[model samples]
Target chain A: MHIVDGALSNPVLIGGGLLAASGVAYSLKKLEPEDLPRVGVLSAVFFVASLIHVPLGFSSVHLILNGLLGIILGWAAFPALAVALLLQAVFFGFGGLTVLGVNAVNIAVPALLVYFLCRWGLSAEKHLLAKRVADGLFLVFFLITIWAGFALYQLYQVEGGSWSVTVNSVSLILFSGVMAYGYFLYRRGILSVAGFWGFLGGSLSIFLTAVMVAISLALSGEEFGKAAEFVIVAHFPVMAVEGLLTAATIQLITKVKPELLHAVR
Target chain B: MTQVLGEVSRSWTLDKHQQTQEAFLQSLDPRVRLLVCVLFSCVVSALHDMMALTLALGIGLGLSLFARLPIWTTVRKVVVVDSFILVLVLTLPFTMPGEVIFSFWGWEASREGLFRAAEVGLKANAILFSLMALIGIMEPSVLGHALYRLKIPIKLVHLFLFTVRYIDVFYKEYKTMRMAMKARGFVPRTDLHTLRSIGYLVGMMLVRSLERSDRIMEAMKCRGFDGRFYILDTMKSGPRDRIFAVVSAVTLLGLLAVGYL
Candidate 1:
């Protein structure tokens, strides 16, 4: 998740920048010429991946895939993240050079976690190919499941709501349910008319919100609006639509490329 | 979208790229330019006045023109830096409570904030342009050497160098991954699906990169890379370079007074 320029102080930016630079340096130090190409390519994929946004709550959350990046780059995910973010900042102006450090930390840490889990749990199977593949699959499930929970926990903290993380059925429904839904949507629609449905459904909420916002503004006169009205009438639906769109878009990508779901070592 | 993204090439074979780089080095001492860039950033950052910020931007623009770097390129480069400052600017007229010029969602936009935004906008633009020129002039290799000579840890220099060199490598790897995905007749599934796919994609990439690193280290061992790096590069600092450094430093110091005091 981007810290959205000016989300924190300049000092934070500098501190984050230092960390990002150091993290990248650390990643680079461990790199070989051969590894360099893969890092660069995957970072580019990560770059492209983030461009595809899905609605999530009040905001559209693009996939950072940092967890996956970590699984590949290990600590080296830092440079991959930094460089990609730098490109994004330069090209899309999504983030700025000043805040590159902070953004990298946000994305790279989770990626590192996935990388470690993958290396230890999957890569350990040197002798048996079958065992490695199976174990890698298991590890991927474990990593992604944990990542889902972690993201929710983070969401709770950011929302100033109950810090209480209910990891049970409700929370599971909130987290795993979405993943399952996307899986279902993806598998069922590899092609056919489903693609349009997928795209339509993916962006439907955002489009709906726009319609509603437009209608509301048309109905209600400006200058008569209050804070409570904005939240109750405007904010909540935008958030819900955002979440739905995010879910749908992510599902679309998964459906198209199943290998992205391959278990990592 | 592709065109807007600019020409995607890491290796520049153009003579101009080399000439521009040489011209920069020919102009001033590396240490002085680095200090001026860093110091100017500091002074401009601390002050939140529009007039002062504009002055800085004007100065930066003037410098760029003098340097003979295309004005459009500088603008593009400056915008990258500007995004960081604009985030702050965009918030100013809304968050800071003052005379209400505009209000929405129970939030009031203040007159002061607008002016403050202007100040920050100009200041940030100026600082960004200056920094951009500094980077434009100095080759990443030269920077690594300079920093190393200036007592920055050798590890840091090596790290920076490796990062710069491998940046293109990562880009290439990423393209392959995308092609691989596309070959599967995959269309992106929307939300969590996309995240999951991306998650796996990034994970696979990281794993591959590290594996490649191991092989590379082994390869290097087959050659010779005793940890301490020997610089084959030798840059002679001239009297003109020393004078250039002094002038920039004095200029920055003078600019600080004009901006701050």
Candidate 2:
């Protein structure tokens, strides 16, 4: 979810813009000559993915794929997603040009986190269980970080707003349940050989979607419980579907070219 | 899904309504237009007062009219594009703390929220309309050239051009894959089985895309391609572009002054 032009306060915009610029600068410096085409191709993939909608019951939602991009491209996801977003702003006006920097950071930062936490374990093919655990841990940790009021402060200046004990406790329980389910899938040996990859992918999709919705609503000044209700409850079905798709995709890749996973790591 | 695909492809079409319209905005230098648009958006963002926002919006509307862009369609497009922002505005009245005009279920519509929402709405609409009137007139190639001339990094520009050029090709590939899945009796449902199949579809697309990228790299290298991308459209900022710049700057500054009052 993008914060449109003039929607955010000036300070947040400038701060986000500067941070995003530095991330891009670092990415550019880190990029090798051989990596240019890969980055460009992945950029096109990300751009096209948004156009492919996944049908929910009545309405459909486009794919974000930020997590997928992060796992594959690492820091390169920053520049890659940034270019795709720039085009989205120019062609469709889905996001404003002025807010491009902040929008890029909002999506790409989590991707970096995914890369840092999951890279080693995922690369070690022997540690499939470790990879799933890493993904689950990172996701739950990520949710806790956001739901703990960090997003409310970063995105909006909402004061005197507290998550009701009831809402917080409920969300915490639900999130833990998700984490436990992910672990169960890993242990049950669901899909034979790379089932855990699918689990990781699905969990990442759900985690990213929840975080995106929470921040978007928070920035719009919605209270924590309301945002949580919409993200956790309203988007629950979408999360489940997204996870399954993500897992399947990961499984296919692991079957066809398992080295691709190791390559990114 | 089909609707979104069509809309995405349609947005990239080179020949649109803005091309046929012979307007002053169409004639301005692309670089100047880009700069002015950025400056205008920043100015709009800075203004807090509705009076100033309304004045800014008036200028945007005037420019759109002068450019001969269809008014109704432009308004419709702005509304559609800013739907999320509109939703944010909807929350303002009930969420913000101020003197309440209406209260329901413990939520109050405060004057401050209403005022803030209007400020955001006016600013957002003004920026969108102005962008449509100004930068929307130029071709993507021309805009890429302008960005190059404006000293944006060459690699960034190259990445942008590649993404734009190949998006259609990849979209076609994605559609074909989806069609193949459908042929195989795949129906997307809320179940894990269907979701897994869709995942295979996405993975298959990525693998193909990566392979295609390698081929593209080889082709480019065969043609003696370098890291630097050369912009074909050579645009120079002439006196007319300068005039547009001066006029726009003066108008924005004047609005800023009025906003301060």
Candidate 3:
């Protein structure tokens, strides 16, 4: 999601920079002396979270963790995020300095959402361990899905001028439904290995229908993009690997030091 | 040259890494510097002609010099931060629409593009320089106070102040981790495994950070933080500040007028 230096129109770049500066400046003004240490840690966390990747079929998809970072940092998330992204752009060429504002705004919105969601949800008495985890995961999924919709729109504007608007609207709906169900499975813990294997057995009943779509698409040769899209979407091996690793890491943390979740602000 | 440039670039890419231009900053009100930042940005965007871009560049350079910023520091700020811009500048002939200055491959390079890119490069450099000058002249706390003085939303300003205030914590932890890696011989040479190791290391850092936040917040509450941070506002605009503002504005306008008419 890095906007290279010259990729945007000049007005957008400068305008975005000004807005980001405004946001960062505002964040700076609101900070208390005691909030310093947490800002440091949260910045570190947000910076590092974006580096972990899950391999997708054509390309790798990374967990942004903007949601989690925002959940933790509240209003303080933007400055930390801006700095982190700036560090990435400057050091690693992940984004351009020109579009640093755009990058900050993209990620900061979701991170802020996480803060609000947790602050409100956790404040409710009905919060359970399962609910907290679900809520966290749900927020991440929704945030990502929304951003993905925006991305599709941007791409459509680039690639599909006249049809772009309608494509965006329909794609967003389709994306939300698919993303939500996947998130549901994640929330229910069915995204794990044993649960995944159990769910695969039911799809076995409709295996022929799915196979026929593949056969017809392949025979026609023109519909391969659609077929490949399915392959891209259904590629479980990569996600399984990531999910297992994530689960293992979390389990390690929980076992080694449950105090991480125990001590709450 | 690539390695040395890369090393040099690595060292000074972050604007704050250089020695500040605090000498000129001594005389001004923080509020004026803050206004200078806005007026400078507005001028940067408003620039459309070569003469204007050049004049603005000259005046921005003068401002930096007035702040007593060293030439080397100013050069590093431009070279390191805007290399991508240099890349775009080089690519301009391919993308820009106008009369051809040169032809090669399938595309002809445009004279207009060369000029346009020069304008862009100049404008971009001016933005960086003017900002550096402001940062140089103003203490970050002063910058914060200046924003508070401007009636910017208190929440946003507080975040930047805190982030800048505590960035050292993250850097220190990063240093320790790097040192830990070095001691264990975890140097990254040419290998994808190294990338993976770095990725895992990054993951671990996030976990460590998440673990760190609760403790920090608890400590903040102990200090009677009711959310409002005050940087004792010591700045009241005086004669020098007024002159500085008027002179800068008039000079910028004169340049703008020369460019258009």
lDDT of each model, Cα atoms only? 0.50, 0.68, 0.53
Residue B66, candidate 3: alpha-carbon lDDT:
70
TM-score of chain B of 1: 0.81
Cα lDDT tens digits for candidate 2, B133-210: 777655655666678889877766776666666777778888888888899898876445666676777787788877
Number of the predicted model whose lDDT against the real structure is largest: 2
lDDT of 2 at A81: 84
The candidate with the higher lDDT, 1 or 3, is 3
Query: Which residue window of length 10 is worst by lDDT in model 3 chain A?
Result: A197-206
DockQ of each: 0.10, 0.50, 0.11
lDDT of 3 at B173: 65
lDDT of 1 at A71: 40
Compose the digit string of candidate 1's lDDT tens values, residues A1-265.
3333323346666766687677766666676543443454445545655554545544554544443345434665676666666545544445445556766765665456545444443323353553444334434543554464465456545543342344222444443454344345534744222222222222222323333333332232222122112222232232233334433333343455433323222
Q: Rank the candidates by TM-score, best first.
A: 2, 3, 1
lDDT tens digits, residue span B1-261, model 1: 133244332222235556455444335656566666667766666565556667778877766666555557556656655654554566567655579988866557889767756765665566556655554455555655666777765554555555555545655676688689889875565444554465456445544554565565676667775655676665556686687677777776667777668
Q: Candidate 3: lDDT of A69?
A: 51
lDDT of 3 by residue, B152-234 (tens): 66654565455445444555565678689879987654233343454345446656765666666676668876655666655
lDDT of 3 at B133: 62
Off by over 4 Å in 3: A1-40, A44-76, A82-103, A106-265, B1-22, B189-192, B210-212
Q: For candidate 3, write residues A1-265 as lDDT tens digits.
A: 3334333455555656777787777766666655565666656554545544544434565545454455446666777787667445433434545557866765565455545544444333454653555555546545754664575456546644454456455645654554455446656764532222111211211122223323332342221323322422232232233333333333333345444322223
